[model samples]
Target: MKNIILSATLLAMSAGAALADAHSVVRMGTEGAYPPYNFINDDGEVDGFERVLGDELCARAELTCEWVLNDWDSIIPNLTSGNYDTIIAGMSITDERDEVIDFTQNYIPPASSLFVALSEDADLEGGVIAAQTNTIQAGYIAETGATLLEFATPDETVAAVRNGEADAVFADGDFLLPIANEDADLMVVGDPVQLGGGVGMGLRETDTELREAFNAAIQSMKDDGTLNALIIEWFGEEAATF
Candidate 1:
């Protein structure tokens, strides 16, 4: 989904100079809230599938890297402003977003978006649906007859449904399936919505060199089957891969 304000900034930066170098200690940005993708562990360190994948990527590309946490809403803005060198967040590659920032070839393939509710019969078509602000799911809901409620974080979107603030929460199936399986009160309510091209790393349009480096790294993982293994490890065997 696109935000007009950020789109303006992105367009402004698209023609600017590249901010990364081969020897630079690349700063990797993430939300540190969405689990299995990226999150802060008990040790207060950035930990998750992205963490491991990012580390390997850095090694393969022979670049030093450090993690930077940013709120999801401002992740792109911060990157454009040079707060980080790249976004290793589980961001989907979409035409609307490609207008703002460049994306590497997808590390995670296009996957289903599932609707989760407290009851099996919950109204999914016309009911109020919760989704994280600025996400594809939120954009999809806005086009439907259903009322869309936006939250700042993925957890908050799920909380909205649990607390009856919304009839259902829609998000990546990988993110919601674990929650649904662990909670007896929650269940998937409808067929999965296929959204976005796939999940990939976001980089400034000017950072072509850096993007190419990471792209090569990702391709290596894919060829060796490490990428698929990581997908299965974090999201189960059913999760889509490159």
Candidate 2:
């Protein structure tokens, strides 16, 4: 899930005016830390499902695009400041985020959030829970009987659970599944809780032209079944698809 702080309306207005013109090389922003969505590979290049998907979408939209890595906490701020043209990170479409920026129709459908812990018997409702700062999971935990521990990154949240800093880490099921499967010490602890609408590309409210281009490109992929194929290829056959 996604969330962001509101930037000054005047600043957004100025940036929008400057970006209204057609771009020669549209910049794509991401947090290259979250794996299977976006991450740095051995070659020192951004690699993962979003990297591949973003490139294809750009190609389809006939736009020359470059990738920029930003900290997740500041991604929206940088975008509003005109550091990048769009956010193709694994950002879920939420009204909270929409208050600061616009989003394309979700590329990934609504998915479940799950809890991962050192033990299968970890308390689901009252234990200390770890979640990445500013995420919907963190907000959700704050409302529950659990004590919420916030970390700067997803990896840190998982590390918290592993190191006994918290009872469990709550996060996207897709992001946690591979980790749980590979590690015998960690296991999923409770029933899946569906969260957010789905994942979408984040754009500035002023970039309607660019947003429409990517939306059309995404729709084309869905029409041809290529989007579903890419989903299954990256997230397994059981993964949800449009």
Q: Which ten residues in a row have the lowest lDDT in candidate 2?
A: 1-10
Candidate 1 regions with alpha-carbon error over 4 angstroms:
1-23
Tell me the TM-score of model 1.
0.91
Estimate TM-scores for all models.
0.91, 0.91
- Candidate-wise lDDT, in order: 0.87, 0.87
TM-score attained by model 2: 0.91
45-86 in candidate 2: lDDT tens per residue? 999999999988877766778999999889999999999989
Clashes of each: 0, 0
Which residue runs does candidate 2 get wrong by more than 4 Å?
1-21
Single out the weakest 10-residue window by summed lDDT for candidate 1: 11-20
Candidate 1, residues 1-242, lDDT tens digits: the string is: 23543443343233222323443688999999999999999999999999999998877766778999999999999999999988988898899999989999999999999999999888888999999998999999999999999999999999998899999999999899999999899999889889999999999999887887777777767776789999999999788877
